[model samples]
Target: MIFNRVSYGFAAAAAGAFLFFAPAAQAMTKIERVVSPGGIEAWLVREPSVPLIAMEFSFKGGANQDPVGKPGVAYMAAASLDEGAGDLDAKAFQARAERNAVELSFRASRDEVRGSLKVLSDRKAEGFDLLRLALTKPRFDQEPVERIRAQMLTALKRETTSPNEIGSRLWWRTAFPNHPYSLPTNGTLESVPTIVRDDLTGFVSRTLARDNLKVGVVGDIDAKTLGTVLDQVFGALPAKSDLRAVPQARPEAVGKRLEVQLDVPQTVVAFGGSGIPRKDPDFIPAFIVNHILGGGSFSSRLYNEVREKRGLAYSVYSYLLPLDAAALFMGGTQTRADKANEAVGLIEEEIKRLAENGPTEDELEKSKSYLKGSYALNFDTSTKIAGQLVQLQVDDLGIDYWERRNGLIEAVTLDDVKRVARRLLNGGVLFTVVGRTQTAASAKQGG
Candidate 1:
């Protein structure tokens, strides 16, 4: 999933969890790239100030590795990872973790299967043991599998009536057509049920291997100790993952407006189009531009134009969504059913306006300042810091990326913003709305 959220809460297609955490305060954080004797590497931040340690790691392939008919195999596998392991049953395993104060979970996102662990420094041995077993010796017992699948089935059922889910998934299906990108990260209603134990085990063996792993740890653990922990927990996995090649894709059906008419009171709107990938030279500038356009909260052009001035919707937002396979410029809003067309029209107008003229000098400077100033807040906690390091590794940003991040923001020149604005927004966005709207007959958007 893209760290920048897709509005309607479904942009990453919501297979599972993706948590965004910023690096710790620049002065306090020193990231250590620790490599184990067994050749495992982890980014570590030793914060003895807290007795708790937090670690996060991920394997490269997520739902992208699911078999053709089973979209949620990765998701179900991840959710079931800790259900039992080695000699432990589900109840015993969970109880042991609780007694030792270990917090652990696994989740599948669009691009990776992720795991997080937190434990008291005194309980490190027990926590690491549990994690190791979960990774290399997961049981995937039948009872637990049925339980987790049932839970997921219930959630999918709820999404049937959720306008947000309907609109978000519809937009994705429209955007990518036949590619894997079009499928929900969590499989469709029909595919999940057929995922048996063999499928879950296949996903693990094919994707969760040492070569594709990235790890980050924060709090209490020193580099030498962490090196040992890394080897112990990860050393036993297969040396290489058998990840299949997934093609790079671009959003299709640009400038088109599609709808699903449900009898909801307010309309759910999701819109997006082509975007710059994370590694693109212009991405940082695009990020700042997006902030000024819609991410600046109450002061953004989108919020000010659509909500504060015209009162068409209660909230409106846009973000840059750079995924492993594709990138997107996305946004969402909800408004009274009667006002859906006007709200969408106003959104398009603002997009066109921004792409045509670019942001004002004031908007540019303030957004830069806000973005730089608020960054360290994301890493205030040990869990957040740990998660962030893992994410940075996934993005392949340098070990020193955090130190240089604010400077990059400062360097986004007016010309840079203007160029990226036209480059990104001029193409227009695809709109997928759910609800009965007053202007159902309105011409298709992105035309």
Candidate 2:
């Protein structure tokens, strides 16, 4: 009986046929506001589910706000919070959280830092107090800080020699030169050593302003009570300067090729061109195109060509990283050293073919259908919905974005998709190879 929920696949199949046939349904869900006495603002959705409460605290200026030479300050600070807080030691705090069945975590992305908390209804006060301590009174204990820093440093040192990491970092640096977005979210070795306690403190103080905080609470909680809880957690944060201003991203050099030789059996190749920014009028169409290209998993062009037909790589995929200023379209595959070049060639050929002759009607319909039909599955939980809402807010999407999102996907026409593919995929494509060099003898021997 539970298997009946698996209707998304069929719904997706019907998406293409009904694109223009059905009228848009009423989509807006009225967001309940939670306004605290301290002037904190939050969107509260009260669902009396299983006696639990989940809240998301989102602050602007995530990894992008990391100071130059300190690339991972945001991540480092986020990681340090759980290590120690208030008077409790790191292990003690963790044990306490587990004992109380509370889930509190911090994560940092390019443009936002999120602190999430989930707890039982009865222990909401205590759970929230612990979260507040982590947010506003983290100790940055020397012992735990050093241990975590050493762990991260060791990882960075190891990743430097990894072919996958080498190719990925190279792509970002080449694709986004002179932009904060170009910096690695994980701090480099040189930068990690310089991150003192004061650096973490200063970053938290400046970036965690009340004005910059957006709270979303869901589950068994009233708007009034949730507003009070928000104040308890975020009211102590000092009012500081707006840290939301992101630096303008420089234009990416498309169609560029880069190669790195590492002693390995397989070569890793990453290639693609620029893509539409989040605010582009063609964003929906471009999204559809991306899904058709590789974002649709087994049903995509790259997978069909590279994996199924030529067997060039075990897996190949493409995706669109649509940001505020610009978008980066990237894809990659790993193959045997000798076959690496051939695989890259095939990928390039496919890119050119898509440019020269746009997607077929069938392909376009399948892509649009998949894009619209599968979106509902992404919001199965309140936590996920809150996260999506935060991103929509950061992108300046309207309040009714979630309601109208499916309609926009349906509006993307075949021509619209073709136009975006031509316009956005013009950057100098980078060809990065990370593997052992094939000797002349090996080349001649076809080994």
Candidate 3:
């Protein structure tokens, strides 16, 4: 499945070294809007320096569109797309892909059916055709279907009691009760067994179409040429998507605390509260405020108070999860089971402190400088730019967003930061803790 949402609420950011090429990357990124002969639209960034082409595209329906009592239908459908199609069986299709060195895959994310393709410039033709077939004519033969099902079943069994998985799932379920947004993107063990061939076929027919699509391409391609390829690949699909409308959802039960008992030594903690959606005017400020609160790694208040000063945990962090239907601010930490209560209490203290007193002028300036400087890394490679383009389209951020983004960050005044801090953090966050077999009482408010 398209697992851009796969990390759930607590997936830690992978540690990495910074490669700063901010100036050149900013100058080199000139996004062009490309419309095909058949009127398919795509965002293109040309990087002739690279000999490869990478494309990312998505249709707006995802695993959330899973039928009632049948979560993971879209996931199974996405995973099975390349197993077989048209004249090629699963083996033949995979062999062709391997021989051509073309990388192509599809996923069912919470909000979209997403796909990515990468190929040597010379092999792009094979790659695009393979993507077309996979999108339009998947065979979904029984053998490959059975194999993938078994693999998914194995993973589900392994994760049945996993601390992180259990805590993350619980957080979502509790936050969005009885809503499709609460359903596991991967179908549950109970739901997966009942899924049959028709569900897969039906998901493809209803969800994958031109009207709901967005495309992005980068590396060694001109707008004129990509226009033709776009039509050849996506032009044949039906113009309209047959999708059920998903309503806007808000996270429920703020300040509610729940815990699961397990034997693990480290308690896994997930906490979050109301968020300003990406489209909100306050999101950029919220983004900056969040960086100061917990998103900035070593420099954040949470890391400094809980880990740097008290040494209660090796890591602590948070993020703004603005889904298509909901806006959420979430964070997580792992610490000694005995220290879970302390870590959580400190986190609560920092959030309320920031909400009551906005970040200092120096902290605000540092966060802005860091955000502007780090943005260049987003465009350092063709793949990264392509991914960003697709996401920009998904967010409906205008074509000029890249040009305007840093300016928006620069425009946030101290007053703006304070206003958004209360907007996002004034109310306390919900908490879900796993691995503290002894009940850790609710987070106590104190300095």
Each prediction's whole-model lDDT (CA): 0.84, 0.73, 0.84
lDDT of 1 by residue, 1-447 (tens): 211101222213222222332334653458898999999999988877556677889899998889986888888899889889999988888888877767788889878999988777888899899999999999999999998888778878888888888888888878988787787887777988899999999999999999999998887788999989888999999999999998999898888888777788889999999989988999999998899889888989999989999898989999999999998999999998888889999989999999999988999999999999988777766677778898899898889998889999998899999999999899878998888866553322211
Write model 2 residue lDDT over 1-447, tens digit each, in one string: 000111232224334331222112221155576789989887765666346666777888788888767887888888888776898988887777766667777877787777877666777887788888888889889988887788778888888788888877777777778777777787788888888898888778878888778777666788888878878988898876457467566446566566777777788888756777888788788777777777888998888988999888888888887665556787888998888777877878877777767778899888878777777665556666556656666677766777778888878787887777776554446666667645321111000
Candidate 3's residue-wise lDDT over 222-279, tens digit each? Answer: 9999999999999888899899888898888788778888778788998977888998
Q: In candidate 1, how many clashes are counted? A: 2
TM-score of each: 0.93, 0.87, 0.93
Model 2 stretches with alpha carbons more than 4 Å out: 1-30, 242-245, 437-447
Q: Which ten residues in a row have the lowest lDDT in candidate 2?
A: 1-10
- Model 1 quality (TM-score): 0.93
Candidate 1, residue 427: lDDT: 85
Candidate 3: where are CA atoms >4 Å away?
A: 1-23, 26-28, 440-447
